[model samples]
Target chain A: MGKHIRTVNANQAILRSTLQGRGCGECQASCQSACKTSCTVGNQVCLKEKKQ
Target chain B: MIHKFIFDDTRMVFDVHSGALHIVDELIWDLLEAYGALPEEELAQSLSGKYLEEDISEALEEIKELTDKNILFSPDPLGGAYKPPGESVVKALCLHLAHDCNLSCRYCFAGQGKFGGAPGLMTAEVGRKALEFLVNSSGERHHLEVDFFGGEPLLNFDVLRMLVDYGRSLGREKGKEIKFTVTTNAILLDGRIGDFLNKNDISVILSIDGRQGVHDAMRPFRDRKGSYDVVVKNIKSFLESRDYRDYYVRGTYTALNTDFSCDVEHLASLGFDNISLEPVVAGEKDHYSLRDSMFSQISSEYEKLTRSILKMTKEGRHINFFHFNIDFEGGPCLPKRMSGCGAGHQYLAVDPPGTLYPCHQFVGREEFVLGDVFTGVRRGDLTRLFRNSHLYRKEGCGQCWAKFHCSGGCHANAVIHNGSIEKPYSPGCLLAKKRLECAMYLAQWKNAPDKS
Candidate 1:
């Protein structure tokens, strides 16, 4: 009951322990999410996404 | 800004700007809901009915500590300070090699692959000019990508082969590394094509709409013959030839098959590791188009898919479902996160005749045509228009909790549905938010202590 907050990133506490260094770049748009696999660079929103 | 929610038994809060997540207990969760609106004593008074004075005080202390660390209620890092990159260089091009396709799928968005244009194939000369344009427009960027698209790129196999070779030589001469990818229905994929793809290190995107029955119903040939058998067989053999590397199967879910998770599971069961099944974009008049009424069903399917992915991961048979692939820690850099896909800016699409558009979806629309490969992007006004279309500039995105994750959604979808890029398609918005929730929830489960 006393423990109330768990941080997920480097800002404070370790929030996503298993996801610490995982995930692609900060996806800014839904290009990847919209067509993801198929559209590859169809929209070219997030530069860091793995090249299709 | 902070977004908080409860999934299963865990309560989590996400700081949008800093991209931080917090798991809080019930007391802290409730306190956060009222934290900013009232004074500390007033907040405690409001929650006194449920918690003791000592407990309320301790929870308040925890909240204070977290807030002081800037982990919660973080300020917008781009508050009027974000400046667009000084120069936008072309990085990727979707080259529509052939306007004519062998399949006439009912849900074909490109008007049966011709994209509302006359059936034609891109000549070798046009293909060469397109590659040269990309190389010249790329500026100082070392690595570039070119995707061979069409009614079917394989239909123009000879020209595509020559272009790939020419692109390789051009890359070596210009000090650029060009990566190639081709998206096809797989009707024409054979051993030779597969071998060429592998040798060229070109990635492949195979189109198959899940199970044989479902795929056959949606994607059929010009003769109305089901292409499921041929497509799957070709894909299987192609995967075998390439040793199953750098490829993914992409599908579209329409009103015809709202239970799309089954399709995802079907592909997984078929031994395909990477897969993407997206909602079909069609006019409201189209019988197979998704409407507001169907959202609940679609959402549930997404949930089912999430659970399936989690269970599969537990068994060491994880399928890389594209939508669920969210990187909280390693997402795009800051500027890209705010700007979204660089369509019309960093990316452009070339039709068979070498006419350029912002992206593939906007190919046939004359208004979106930027210029041809010969003259380069002459429509500077259009480029500027797309360049300024950022998440913050989008209408109604300010209050959305998932705005940062989706980066204001797809511009083309918005234009098609609402007639303006600033106005988002509400259905797509709702679907994207739901997917983001599922993705975040999956992330939570994967990081949970019980995960193996």
Candidate 2:
């Protein structure tokens, strides 16, 4: 079979999964608007991947 | 459903059900569109003229392997009748310290901070009661959050300081830990206030719209004078005092500034590491509402901003754009992913007068007023309504690929525009989809094997 597709699962990334299931807990705490925290839920568990 | 998009020569596919992402070659990408419609042999036979027979067969096998692993085209995990946990606890509250604002922002969502009522500041007693209500309603949740929000919270600086101290003492006595944050316009952020926030380990969300022109245009003072100079000066000092940590330089981009990415870049250039730029939410008739015609321009701006972020990361200069900050591995759990920011249930907003609303955005709406803090969530019906507003229950989210990421979008915006929380605001949805596409593309590039 042709292995043409390359995939990266979420598990491979170096992220702190500690905030999972806390659902908008911290975001609602800091948020002032509806759209402000659209992607901020993940921000609670801050993405640490910085490719240099 | 698997969502696919191409950005800057990169083809990325997102597995909606499993929240898995894949970067595929052109062949597999096209093949995926027609997948599951027919048997493997029949599918290959139909595309024989376009692709090699052996290549088609091989790709089908690969797809089958991923599907079997439940990484691609996975079935919906919640299945049809998913019931949310019955019990709800208050985990966070947005406390409006002052209902009046110093600078009259043209895009003021809370009707210039008074929220259509007489301008007032929260008394210390009201603040104390709000905290007490949170403690009692929180049940077993030990980690509670309270945000000092307002037309301008600094206007009630005395009450805010008193409440922080009171809340901390209450937490200690109750064996709970409370985290505090404040959203301010930076107009009154002097050295003393900065020291208090830093010492208390309180996070700050400083409001500064981008470049001077764009910021002043949207956010100006009572006399119509520009606030950019004063705000920028104060924020720079505050950022340095905090050692450049635990703060967000947040802004809102309106239709007037379609090149919103430049505003983000402007903030970055000013030495602010953490930034969040959001689109303005206003009635369609408002001049700044982000009308339909401006979507493409705004979308392109997001792409440009994405590239800028990558460039900065490649060098030593690092920044955290709140919107692009996606956590792949440690994202919110399925339930949180299905039901976003538990407004009216887990999270609620308290007005200066001690009345509570679902969230900050709904503070002025009479119908959304849940109850007074003294009474503690008298409207069980409204709380249940928000608890039931899950991804599957939303009008289009069940079939949409970005459901898990956005968690059915904002309930307040939906209710304001569509008159129901079950419906999503189309304009907000459009912006979200574009941002998610860009975010996935960035994730793919960042996690690529070649980079490592």
Candidate 3:
């Protein structure tokens, strides 16, 4: 069970890294707010990260 | 991986990265979303309201942003931040290759191809210089296009070849592509020339009004003989070749050829991919005695021909009316001020004697000369000609619905027809409005339920 959870966590980290590389690729977040209405998943992730 | 998100048109894919939509450039996006498939007339009507001013102002700001991004391009080949009064981006260069022609068409704008007053053939040296000028002036990033025009470009073959070679060399050096096109009478086009042209990937626009009789009446050789047979034979020869078969051969027609049914079919049979029908510019005499009845008859014939062509294109017949049709998510038609006409900004045509004019049509007008190409491109004069802010119609055209679409019509034509560019020229404007209305009506009809 612990090994399975570790694997899941590793997958999540990989996904998060990919998303981070792409979303913050420009490094300038000028278009982040403008895209909120269009991208619910990204917005939720951003909000969750903010809370964390 | 580029996550693609398409809005409005599925053909245009908007790249989405993470949650943020990767906007190619703010101008193109704004132009796409702002207009939102609204036909010109409907768009105009929407803009007629007072409350729309703020929205338009905001859209214009986005357009400026897009202009800065370099994604939304002007038709002008000369790259600059210069915006003319009430004009959109410069879209095309009206280059004239030879002011002299073998044929003396009655209504020839260069005065029956007479050599006395007008400038002669553009030299190979001038052509190379011009190509170099275009490459340098277009900046390091953008592609360049050259349209070889004249009383007849074939008359000056050496210069044309040199220009093409120079353009290719410049393009290779700069890591840019160059597009070359020529407009000619086709009387001079032979089998050898046709084969050479086919191999070179050059676009040829032939002038053959409708039929032999109609064409002969308008265009005749210096010896007063009809050269229709020779032209038709040459076109057939070119079309028969496998290489030239796919080449874009556009047929230019004048309004005098009123028999739509016969002309359209005849031209189509000749293997022309596109047909550009222009209304005859009434000379000094005809202008005063312009008849509404004559115009209506011509308009009706044009409408019928356009309908047939549209139907053909819809049925996948490959015939395109490029002068009227726009590509998917394309920039505004002639009217949009966002990227105005090429004129003094993007392109300047040099006559034989080395006087640089805004365009070929304005070549003889001494006042329009930007400078001599031999002395190098005059930045000051070119700038003054380009940023003629006084030329823009802030009062009348700024508030117009078609402001983003038509860009207030041709400046040279306006000055020639009317006394100034401040007021819109009647003929081109009226014709554009009529055409736009027809396009909108057709779009609606196509979407409507069948009547069967």
DockQ of each: 0.20, 0.27, 0.02
lDDT of 2 by residue, B1-452 (tens): 78888998888878877777888888888788788887777778888888998888888888888777777887777774457878888888899999999998999888888999999999999999999999998888777888899889999999999999999999999988888888999999999999999999998989998999999998999999999999999999998998988888999989899998889889999999888889887888998888889898899999999999888888867778877777665555565666677887988999998999988888988999899988888899999999988778999878887777777788888988899999998778888888888788777878787752
Pick by DockQ: which candidate is best? 2
Q: Given candidate 3, what's the lDDT at residue B165?
A: 78
Model 1 misplaced regions, further than 4 Å: A11-52
- Estimate, for each residue in B34-60, the C-alpha lDDT of model 3 and write its tens digit: 453676346545655633555555554
Please state the error at residue B275 of candidate 3 in Å.
1.1
Off by over 4 Å in 3: A1-52, B1-95, B114-119, B242-255, B258-262, B286-293, B310-318, B332-337, B379-395, B399-401, B444-452
Stronger candidate by DockQ (1 vs 3) = 1
TM-score of chain B of 1: 0.97
Which should have the higher TM-score, number 2 or number 3?
Answer: 2
Superposed Cα deviation of residue B193, candidate 3 (Å): 1.7
Residue-level lDDT of model 1, residues B1-452, one tens digit each, is 78887766778888776677777888988898988999888999999999889988988887777677666786666563446766678877889999999999999888888999899999999999999999999887877888899889899999999999999999999998888888899999998888899999988888999988889898999898899989988999999888888888999988989989999999998889998888998999999999899999898888889889989988889787777787665555555655666788787889999999988889899999999999988999988888888777888876777766677777788889888877877888788777877777777777665674
To one decimal, what is the Cα RMSD in angstroms of model 3 from the true structure? 15.4
After the best TM-score superposition of candidate 2, give how far the Cα of residue A4 lies from its true spot, in angstroms. Answer: 1.2
Which candidate number has the best lDDT?
Answer: 2
Q: Judge candidate 1 at residue B241 and give its lDDT.
A: 87
